[model samples]
Target: MTSSPLPSGHDVVVLGGGVAGCVLAARLSEDPRRSVCLVEAGPDYGPGQQGWPASLLNARALPRDDVWERHTAFYRIRARVLGGSSCVNGAWNTWGSNADHAEWTRAGGERWSAPALEPYRRRAVDRMRLRAAPDEELSAWASAALEAAGELGYPEVDMGAPGAPGRGRPLLNAVDGVRFNAALAYLDAQVRARPNLTVLSGALVDRLVVHGGRVRGVRVILDGRPSTLVADTHVLACGTYGSPAVLLRSGIGPEAHLRLNGIRCEVDLPGVGANLSDQPGVFVPRSPTPELDAALAAGEAAGNLYVSRMLVRAAGEYCPDGAWNLHLLPTAGPPLFGKLAPGRYEAGISAFLMKPVSRGHVRLRSADPCEPPVIEPAFLTDPDGRDAAVLRSGLRKAQQLADALAELAGPSDPVPAHTLSDADLRARVGTYWHPVGTCAMGPADEPGSVTDGQGAVYGVRGLRVADASVLPTVPAANTQLPVLAVAEMLADTLRA
Candidate 1:
């Protein structure tokens, strides 16, 4: 809603001012010598939480406002605001197992290892002010879920770091029911006061001006006018969906696809918009007992009602030993989408298939920057049927937890989830909203590898990608914390 004249250029231009973008901008701009410009497609909301909308500031529920597309496919839903998905996510932060780090280390060498990234992870945790769920914040359902996991003989493990798979509460970025987004955490008043940092919001990136195997400049539509912002370095932090789309539009994607879209191919990278991976889950609803409903209503009235506060990190049949592939989340509160009757609420156990093998893609419909890219999650579509089988295993585990809480809630589904047909499972599947691997990191010779271990694009000089888009594989946990740590690590790489 506000407009300002664009500076001619900067030392570094961080595109997409989301979670990673904010962190990159904040860290890269720490040195007064480096002039860093952060461009976001959505509103900046200025400094602090006061200017943010009420829905975005509340951690009790995932806000639909400030998102890219409302009422769209759940998997396609992404935040368009400055803080990115953190502005609209569950505010829960969890870490992955050593196996996740092993997979990353394979693609990106030792830098992607657990021990190597630990320092940056700690920095992100402290900066974001992540804290464990307090006892007072847990509702009766969440409390029971934890008890049930222990009753089922699962050991308690820390959810915010690398450890064996088990049951525990995740670290939250919210405190006292208020969501602390990345913009608030990283782009604080002190960071914004830096004259070297320029945040340009409501600017939609059209394409990169690539020439001679290097980024010459970037064209963005700001204040209804098209302008070019030049920089010595261009960092793509536009996230999984937006990052790949920007590459394709810039004629840096698959040559065949670029030709079809009538865009001149500057780079023939085959992996630009491919290898999309995301976590998908199915919610098994339950009928809450009257007493449970009354208790939840009380929590709601007191403004302490949280949909979910705990989860079980369970290993699937195909999972490697000492690692988990499923998250059994038990939730009971106001429905995420629709409203329930006055005192009634929605209670369910959701089985999320973490680390899914099924890969999807993002493709440009045309060269138009305004046109939303075609996103195919391709959930449960692995050829070997491994993804679907793992999901079924998770569903059975969720049913076990639900059974443990039978006194508080009863099964509302006519049939158990594990027993459901493949078609039925596909129909009921929803995403964890953790999409990654569009501009994946790996060896340059690999077919689908877009970036190297250090996030430098295969053939592009003066360009790098520092976001979830570069993650070669999805970790077996929520992506918020991992992404923050990743951006921190990449910022260090840039600084060095």
Candidate 2:
């Protein structure tokens, strides 16, 4: 990695170097005429950080200085690198269907509807060469599972077409046996070639530089020095909790919430930190195959099936998308996972809800930039909610898929017994870690919406949010693809 001087000024200033921020910065700087500056809070990504090998992508394995462990009252979320979470995420590339988008729009997400964002969808997928089967052969488990779903009358939607549903193979951004983060795609030679783009790492933004109800720049602490960087336009891509925390520090949020924290309101966007959303997943470990055992022994890119059940509630009716996706991961050895003795392991099946109705919030804890934001996700807290119901459905689907593999392979194979119930299965699941919507984008009239359809902050001129935080609802797939689509849309809007 190389180092550079902080830009004195630029036409556009993007806060946070996550996937969305990086992609937008690169796209905005495509024109030699427009200068762009990006500020990242962590150290630059090193050589080993790139490429596959899930073990290396763990938050614990990343350099301590480069990874920030934000501690909230609940739990800690890791993110403190130039590429943001993408640098550490599993990088599963799954896209949602139009039906899924329509439901989001109907559920208070206006600009995020499927039809309205088709162009970005195409662009996001087209940007990379993603195939359903990169290993060139389907695992016996995957093959039997699809055939079982067909035999069981579960409509198989072709996941390749985001609008269609079927038992589809995992379409990954895992390129050449390596992990592809936003930093690689947006900040490679193309962005580097542009004299207009400047990236500064190890810069922790403290607050938005708001002046007379408008954003003028950002005040950050770089290397223990308090500095201010001004710009014509300011974009916050810091992420869900990060963006809201910064805004609250700068006095933008619900009036009561702000005043209680002793902050004078500059922008009373009540929804600034409301409507939090995320999709949590769980893992199912199979007995290891000889190949899987070998990969686990050698430390390679292990894959899995990331599947979700699509369900919606509106007008007292229920709609199921009847489609799901799975990521096939190739793993390192058992020594890394501790799941087995050196050779006693199996590939795993990771299943979760992609689009969940459970909502949460990101609020100021102590008005300290260093303090982690209060993240409260009321997961399954809503007993009468659809999020819980759909998650239950996902559990069933996951079990079905797992059961199908039993017939394809004998008891000696990877997959184990099918005696577990849905409840037993759900208890073993956790999160896929795609959190969004803390700063939802929609019309101002929408009570909990933060930014407008065009990615503009309500009541704050020259301020915009282009990241997963702006999503009104989590999509029915891995969020990296949708985050990229949102950035592509925002870039076009900025250019227009």
Candidate 3:
């Protein structure tokens, strides 16, 4: 837990003290013999006590502090903190469906399937306190939305329960109105007290110190001072954006791109920063009634942190059964959201494409580690136009959800839905902020597989990527629960 100069060497060095890195650092340090060091780019509120930001403390809305730079068209929201985005994100916990992990089986065989992932899932679930809030916990607006959803045939049930279809109240990972982020969950008081584990904040890693095809250490800028950390094992949990950047700066990406960026190629892996995927979404906002506005505000003070109580899992008319897709959740919130800033108290349905076919890629803009690379999501670019079609249908679904609640949310003024053209929908869409798949995992020879089944880098030794970046495909869920499971599952292999 010391925040001073990091030890010169350790058994393991974990880059990015985000969700997965926190879990990895904690689990690996379990064995007293293993010395673990975790580096983070943001300040750590040591032991989650003093100096906690008000935005992070309030669960009513996710913290909107920008952690990374992004092109205006591709607004990639990331939380650069000790606990990562889990500290500031909407606390929606979902594991997607069994089908979500089926794609993983193609690369990692049964080891990556839902059944195989369950044990790790259980381990993660066991580690945290996650469950649906009491029905009475819902604000008046959320209550009305839930009832409206039920009337529209969406039932109340545990969406995370195995075989539980449709939607109910989303399970949250908050405790007593505060975010139960990675630091609080995995690096608890006892875990922090362990002498073998070291956590470093404000340490941004520039590149891996690689030699002889083996990763030896990391070159980091700790509090504006340059230093190198040597380790027996180096895990890149720098998240989708940061992790890939580390690889690229270390001369391990598309050879042509590396050369163009003035970085010498150490490993000409074409998939280092390719295959980026995220949930493309848009919010259908409306003016909130005076009653709902008061309730939304008052609920925050009463330990009712969220704007919504229930989520609607829709397969829509086009996709059903194992092919379940589309997520429509009613939102009632203040102007705290990053994209919805300076906004009035409003209520609306936030609909997103659950399994979009569109794909995107990330490319290095420069060899400098501090420079943000170009993130071209190319959202809604699928050839068949299915992605756009789904989002368009989602607008209709939101309109239906709103229509069911017209008696309550009947906006004092109208918003575009019926009048808005398909082109309008395309222009209004934003990110769900669940970016993943940059450092995708698969069989070594797979075209864009950056890591092997066990999360090992394809052409490197003593280095691996264990985070949202390694996901072979995007899970049609909130991703926090699943991402935690990935770290927990890999902890064992990493331990061995």
Q: Top model by TM-score, which number?
A: 1
RMSD of each: 1.3, 5.4, 2.7
Model 1, 1-496: lDDT tens digits are 1136687579999999999999999999999999999999999887888888999999987888798888888898999999999999999999998999999999999999999999989999999999999998999999999999999988999999989878899999999999999999999889998988889899999999999999999999988889999999999999999999999999999999999999999999999989999999999999999999999999999989999999999999888899999999999998877788899999989999998999999999999998999999999999998898999999999999999999999999889999998888999999999999999999877999999988999999999999999998999999999999999999999999
lDDT of 2 by residue, 1-496 (tens): 1246556678888899887888788788888888888888986653334433454344223222344663322123656877777776645566776655775576445556666677776776666445454433334344445566667555544444564444455555555445556676668765666677888889988998788988877898888888888888998999877888888988888988989888888888888888887775555555555654553334333343221212111111143544333322222223323445545445444455666667788898877788777887656555565655555555445555555554332233333223344454445446667788878877677788788777888888988888888878777667777788878888988887
lDDT, candidate 3, 1-496, per-residue tens? 6878667689889999988998898899999999999999888887754557878866656676636644434456677888887887877677687777777888777778888888888787777678776766677777887788788877666665554446677677776566677788888889999999999988889999878888978999986788999998899999988899899999888999989988889888999888888888878876676666667667766756467768777775456465457788787765534444332466888788878778888888898878877888877788887887777777787788888877657644365553466567668778777888999988877788899878899889999899999986788788888899889988889898
Model 3 collision count: 0
Top candidate (lDDT): 1
For each candidate in turn, the TM-score is 0.99, 0.81, 0.93
Instruction: Report lDDT (CA) for all predictions.
Output: 0.93, 0.65, 0.79
Between 1 and 3, whose lDDT is larger?
1
Model 3 scores what on Cα lDDT?
0.79
Model 1 poorest 10 in a row by lDDT? 1-10
Model 3 lDDT, residue 300, Cα: 62
Off by over 4 Å in 3: 69-74, 290-305, 317-320, 336-344, 411-422
lDDT (0-100) at residue 242 of candidate 2?
88
Off by over 4 Å in 2: 1-4, 46-66, 70-76, 103-116, 136-140, 143-147, 153-160, 284-317, 320-338, 346-350, 383-385, 407-429
